[model samples]
Target: MTTILVTGGTGTLGRLVTERLRADGHEVRVLSRHSWPYAVDLREGTGLAAAVAGVDTVVHCATNPRGGDEQAARHLIEAARRAGVRHLVYISIVGVDQVPLGYYRTKLTVERLIEESGLGWTVLRTTQFHDLVLQVLQGSAKLPVMLLPAGVADQPIEAAEVATYLAELATRAPAGRVPDMGGPEVRTFPELAGAYLRASGRRRPLLNVRLAGKTYHSFRAGGHLTPERAVGKVTFEQFLTGRFPARG
Candidate 1:
């Protein structure tokens, strides 16, 4: 019964990780901003020491994708070290090193911190989640016509699958930088958007617009894809069907 502290325990992946760890009979503490039992903010370094103390491992699922991820990771690493944490498991996105996106850059920086922190650590880089992909599609569908970046491909995995893997990593002895995990299949943005529209019973026209920038170029080059590591079982179509069975 190892005691583990899971940061961002209320978020999408974190919540699933917490549930899986608890189901395995481990003592799990959840750190969130307003949640009970444990309340901690990684960005401000508040309530971190208390949440980390006496924990056997720290699973870092918390992230600020918009900005400030590096500072938050630094604070968490320092707190974990002070608490003498046995292991720190971090969840990162696939292709953080290869992608030129700002969020990916921040994740890469956090990976470096964990590597040089001298603490027992494991970093699992996974592809984007189905939930995130759906959110993006839903947001874009609001336009007059659904517009997608040409040649951009995504390998989106289920959040629950990633959560289960994270729990496995947290229990085992720390292994630095595990192999990347990706969805079972890779699809273009237009394909994904069309699937979403069909699943939602909306017949929105999709226009593939060629985007110009390093970000889109990297995506077009498959920097965000790990074809060899497509280990997830769920596909976008399956996810849509599962989520919107009536529409399907």
Candidate 2:
């Protein structure tokens, strides 16, 4: 079995991926600022060489959504190369190319670095996670009347499924930029808000607020999903019901 190292392995997605890989009987190691129960951290590249000493592949899950992800990703890539890692699998988000948002731009720059490195690599682009939707609910549900975008289309996927896909990618040969993965159904922001309210048994009314901005425009134009390539098993309703299950 090949030795696999996961960056940011303590985070949501990375933790799931690490567990799945270990379950598959591979030698899985995690790199993070804080060492997990099963892995180590390669924070300053000081011990990265030792961490990846005999690793066959590196799964890059470390990312800064705000900015500066490009530099961080480049550093991780360089460390993997130095350690003689054979394959690198990068976990990215969908529509990173079309969005032009700060986070997307950083992800795009990192993708470029991987491409230029000439190492065996694969980029798995997944849509927004359901956790993000939960964040919106918990954060914005406090408002008197929640205002949501009129036409923002999103096809969010589950973090567990995304992690599984990434682990499978790490096991296979590098396929370059693979098909995008998203949820089964395409939904608008208003629809998601309503679903959240219903699931949570909240009586607050939702207002369909028409937002005017480049970001809103991009979202409304289907820049957040892969229409043809949307392939995920979990539906939004299923996710909601599972989280806030109806009492008997």
Candidate 3:
């Protein structure tokens, strides 16, 4: 039974990975800010060793959404190295290298750190999660109308499947930048928003705005979804139906 330490164990993916690993009869340790059986803050340099003690592998699911993700990831990678971690698995997003987004830049930097650390590592790139889709839909409902970039493409996947893939990666030898993961079908943001609205019984009108910007152009060119490596079973429609079956 390998002992695995998971950073950001309180997050959506981390929590699920921890539970799955524990159910598989592996020793699971969660590294979080608050007190737990073990507590560690990769940002504040607190309780790291205790959390990783005797762990055979480390799954890095921690990320800073507002900024500072690179520094935070660096801290965690360094700590794992110092603690003699055997393997490291990093959860990253698809199209990180293709997009110039700040968060994606940080993820790329973290991937570089893991590769340069000379440690056993695997970087799994997954598409946006289903929850993010719902959140975007809900958040945009406040405006006069939900706007979408004309011709923008997307392929969102299930968070649970990503977690399952990460858990599987945790047990395997570091594969070094595995194939990108996405849902089976590719669709547009407007379509997804419409589905979400229908699923949630919302009457918000979706307006397909022709955005003329580099970001919008990139999205329109399918920078968000990977076609060749797309390998997720749960379609966006399936996920929405599962989450909101009533379609109120």
Clash-forming residue pairs, model 2 = none
Global CA lDDT of candidate 3, please? 0.83
Lowest-sum lDDT 10-residue window in model 2: 36-45
- Candidate 1 local lDDT, 81-143, one digit each (tens): 999999999999998999899989989999999999989999999999999999999998888
Tell me the tens digit of each residue's lDDT in model 3 across 1-248.
89998888999899999988988898888887775877766777667767776778999998778876677777777778888888999999887788777777788888998899878999999888888877877888878798776788788888888888899999998889888898777877888888888787778778888966666676677777888866888887788888887762
lDDT (CA) for every model shown?
A: 0.92, 0.82, 0.83
Using lDDT as the yardstick, the better of models 1 and 2 is 1
Best by lDDT: 1
Model 2 TM-score on a 0 to 1 scale? 0.93
Deviation from native of the Cα of residue 54 in model 1, angstroms:
0.5
Give the number of the best model, judged by TM-score: 1
Give candidate 1's root-mean-square deviation (CA, Å): 0.9
TM-score of candidate 1 on Cα atoms, chains taken together: 0.98
